[model samples]
Target: MTSRTLLRLAMAGAVVAGSLTALSVPAQAGNAPKTVPVRLLALNDFHGNLEPPTGSSGRMVDENGNTVNAGGAVYVAAHMKALRDANTIEVAQGDLIGASPLISAAFHDEPSVDFLGKIGVQVSAVGNHEFDEGYAELRRIMFGGCHPVDGCSPAGPWKGAKYDYVGANVLFKNPGEKTDVTQSLSANPQVKTLLSDWGVPALPPVSIKWMNGVPIGFIGLVTQTTPNIVTAEGIKDLKFVDEVKAANVASKILKLFGVRAQVVLVHEGDQVTPNQSPDACSAIPGAGNRIATQVDPEIDMVLSGHSHQAYLCRVKDPAGQDRLYSQGGSFGRVITQVDMQVDTKTRDIVRSSVVADNHVVTRDVDPDSDTVTFMDFWRDKISAVANKPVGRISADITNVGTATGESPLGDLIADGQLAATKTGGNAQIALMNPGGVRAPLTYLTSPASEGDGVVTYGEAFTVQPFNNLMQAVTLTGAQLKTLLEQQFPGGPNNQPFAKILQPSANLSYTYSRSAAWGSKISNIKIDGVPVTDTQSIRVAANNFLVGGGDAFAAFKEGTDVWSGPLDIDAFVAYLGQNNPIAPPATTRITAVD
Candidate 1:
């Protein structure tokens, strides 16, 4: 049995002492019921960044407009421990792992799970990235076992996470038909074993926490749009339900259990402000805003993630009462501290007394000793593979694309994919999706003691960590035009937001936001020649797009398909071939809006 199973078993019968002082009411009444002061520490979208992030990705603008170096498991753990007390319970919104740096991803994200356990996380919501490797893989990570393919790490079999995973809105499907709606969730093999010992369902819809004879309910949810963002194959067997409905149902269940205080942890959020302060609540808006306004009034607070931006806002519930809606910035850069007063007799929150704040995880604090020891253990295991010099750059090649969707790093990646698939795929030009570009090739970042402009395999892995295979396909000029038009804001594709694809140097096009969806792209050219409808072009793209991953359905219509090496391999090879590479000009996608 894993430590997480033991933790759950222990929690089943444990009662934590409450530190709340009794409420002072009218003297006419014999002593009024006491109000327990409860502290909830929350963080979200920590995408396995064990070390301090690099370049702009690592720095956040403070309230004073000064750049503050932020993020690192070491500092995050330190902050979490310092703020924790008898009245505090640590929790997270989601995305604790997946799309991580090589140090963690190479080990199937075990290090991240271990670090979270060490920091004393009691419960966490399931983020979309949790499904990146498929549901079965996620189960393996949660239950503790050897990797079915790679087996265990040098440290031996995995012990699983000490924290419990919750997803009230995610359900299993029976092919095209839905399963029994009335049936509660069944835990997986590991969870079954653990629950068998606790005499409860393998997977409980809500986690009930007891503190000083008071019970608090926690419900976890993911965005309904998860199907569109995650790989199709990974989530084929799962069905994502409506967030508002799921929360309402779970709230009702908790109410039946005599638990009136509730918090909803969701994996969807919005980017309110680019340089927003940790505690700022101005102009907060996004999909999360919609969900926050629609959830049941019984929910006292909603913590969110996935947008990677930070903001603290209060949305009015259906009853016209204000409730908390907040998200901590991604990558452990920020933590949300929520203080609530609960009425002991009613076991309900004194809604008006709730308060929340977002704090930056500054690098100046002394790192946590345990977090450092844990990181060093994994860092030493992969030192040779991680420290190897792959290539060099004259300056920073960032993934922050332009309004037209063209970026220097994207262009370079497209160029690399083109070079990689030239012979095997007979490719003429290449197209890269902007989302695949994770981070920049910074000249100076943490562990940059080696000096600037040096690019290592680890850094390159961080830039293109998906490991998507390179594919070449044949598309008519008209089809290629359709592909470019898909980048617009509105279309039949029903894309709520714009996602532009980066084109190789050999390809160029002009677009206008004011133009209709189908007519937005114009003057499309390949190799400096005007593209004609009758011409057939060979284009290279990562498997994600060619297989219709980012709604680029036009690529799915292509014929004469061929596959090549992984994208990371192509990028590393390109760097070696073109030593001391410079940033490419971002003139490919010209926007006329």
Candidate 2:
């Protein structure tokens, strides 16, 4: 059987112990029976970026307007260890792996797991990106191994993880279904042990944490949107339960087991602010800010990720009561810390009377030795490509838009995806998510008086981060109509984003501002011809979109489905076919006020 430390998965709770006295701060308004002071450190999204990504505009502007360099797992690791040394509990919301750089993703996110372990990531919830390579790979990394596909060493023996991962909502479709290999090899295959031996035995959900001298508990959950967002083939026999429902159920279970002072770590979250979002105790609701309101009352504080936003805002529950909420920005930019003071006498929490903030993980400290070694080992391998210049620029290709809606960078990518699909049948329409573009294009500068006047392969990768595949599918005018309707959430209660893309050329649609709220887009068409609302038209979008990434319920609304290859390959192919390829010679799409 695995030792207790190896089996340790998660924790959530309230406890009174002088152990935290050195790090204890003012109590937050919560209603702890007897407020016992505790310190909690949280981080999310880290996506396994060992080296600082070259062109990321991650340098956030602080209140003083000083933009500082941020990120790199080494700094993150060092920062996390500092918090723990202060007697604080370190927590990670989700997305500890997958969709990372070649060095990490190539190894099935092993480097990330190893780095996180060295830094002491006590517990983490599973996120959607966790399924990037499919369940088989996820199992390999989680249960421990070189992760067969990554070409790691030790040939075939199972290697256990240095940390515990939680999954409250991931369930087997049928009991007695075969588990992913690693799950089977989790404990002793030779001498059998109870199923619960590996944390969440029957159900892949469990809470294991210690607060003060009492065992605190935490419930882990992935979003209900998992099936649509992930590779459908991998999760065929598993079900992703509603996040809210799963959280509620798990909270009660922990309470039943005599564990109180619980917090939830989910791979889902809401609206975020920059590292500099006002130091207000409460957050206003918008796109991703509503997770706090959606959380179960049983949950005290929620550490959420997946939306790639950052904030230390609070939201009132269904009853107008406030709960602490926070999400660290993606790419290891920041580590959020919440200092809660619990009443030593009663186990109850103190309401909004504490300090919760996000701190920058500066590169000041030397990188973690082990993490540095792993990165150094992989750097040489990936540098051959990741660092090489793909193509050169003549003048400049930039998206200097400072507006909030969409950037010129966003438009450029949408055009690129469209260009790739249009080359053949020349797709009539193409859509790309705004979130897909990570950085603006920087033109190369002169050697003496360097200027950001050129774009390179490195710069291009910075713009389109996720390496998803491109998919070309036919969508009927009705599906097209649904695509436009997807711009806003429907019903009295719906999402803030309807998942509509700021599409490329060959497609033109306009909306009346005065039209009833969500039903905005009207004159949508293709080829200057009025697109029949029911007539079918060819559409090209990335595989992530075909599979539904940002709550696009309509893309899947198609009748015939064709899942082919990588979306990035389409881009590479487009550049290859149109060698000496140049950015679009004309502006593709325009949005009117």
Q: CA lDDT, every prediction?
A: 0.80, 0.60
How does candidate 1 fare on TM-score?
A: 0.90
* lDDT string, candidate 2, 426-532, tens digits: 46677877656555545544222233443334345545556677677778887777666665566332445544465665667765444664566667767788788
lDDT of 1 by residue, 40-65 (tens): 99888888899888777787766566
lDDT, candidate 2, equals 0.60
TM-score of structure candidate 2: 0.77
Question: Against the true structure, whose lDDT is highest?
Answer: 1
Cα-lDDT of candidate 1:
0.80
Clashes of each: 0, 44
TM-scores for all candidates: the values are 0.90, 0.77
